[model samples]
Target: MTEAITVMALRQGVYDHFREEGDVFEIRKEDDFSAFWMVKVSDAEALALQKAAQRQPEASRHVVDTTVIDNSELEGLRIQLAEKNAEIERLTRNVPGKQADAPEKSAADVLKMANDPTVEFMTFKAAARKVLGDATPSTKAEIIAALEDKATAP
Candidate 1:
């Protein structure tokens, strides 16, 4: 059951609280109460809401231990970084060109490659794999020279 009360004096301040906390939800549609707005609320709910309306909202913020949280979060990040590095190593273990055992031609030999026009240098391909993957490592010597130039660059 529901009832209408002028409570006009109290209505102004409590309307917002009632709407948020309880079911004083919508204003009535009937053509009446010209001076003040009519909010429809259950008598039981209105009583509780009215009491809540009188009290001020609690002023407080949640307390957190930032040092503890930050340390834990950083530990988690470190673990993830280690896992990612391990995964990268695992994935790249068989990726053709990264073998440490592959033979490396000397700087002098690679440098003399400038004289060999048949030496083909692939832009992105590694010297070792280019020999096996393609017909031959025609330009690796030139690429090695370029690499050495960049390495000794000022």
Candidate 2:
């Protein structure tokens, strides 16, 4: 049978003693008094085991080591990022040229409009529509250039 030690009252000294000695034992705290007795074990291994048992229990159900990162995994992540960037560019190219005035009222435009209070947000869209008219090849290029200009501007 496994030897047991009941610790009725816990003191810092007792905890330190167990930790320093590497003694292992089962501990039970006394409900009535502040004193706790260390579960007595005779054998050398048993004593060590009991001391280990007295140490804090593992709180986490699952443990993960975050220091390890494999080269293949990093390469896979890089490929995924590149693919996402490419897909974004492709989709941006595919956006219908008919709604060319939509971006004119975005956050950048709002900020620009603040600078020039005379330029209404609605009027910006109206001006873009008048300039572009129907969706032509030149209009598509113009819209793309305008988007690039807005993106690159301060």
Per-residue lDDT tens digits for candidate 1, residues 1-154, read 3333423332333443532322244334334333344444556766777677567443311134444467778899899999999999999988755777767644445444545677544423344334334433346554555556644667
Q: Give all candidates' CA lDDT scores.
A: 0.50, 0.48
Candidate 2's residue-wise lDDT over 1-154, tens digit each?
4333433223223543433233343444333222343334446657566565557454321144434668898899999999999998877875644465465444354334334668654555444444444541234345545644554768
Error of 1 at 64 (Å): 15
**Per-structure clash totals for the candidates:** 5, 21
How does model 2 fare in lDDT? 0.48
On the 0 to 100 scale, the lDDT of residue 108 in model 1 is 43
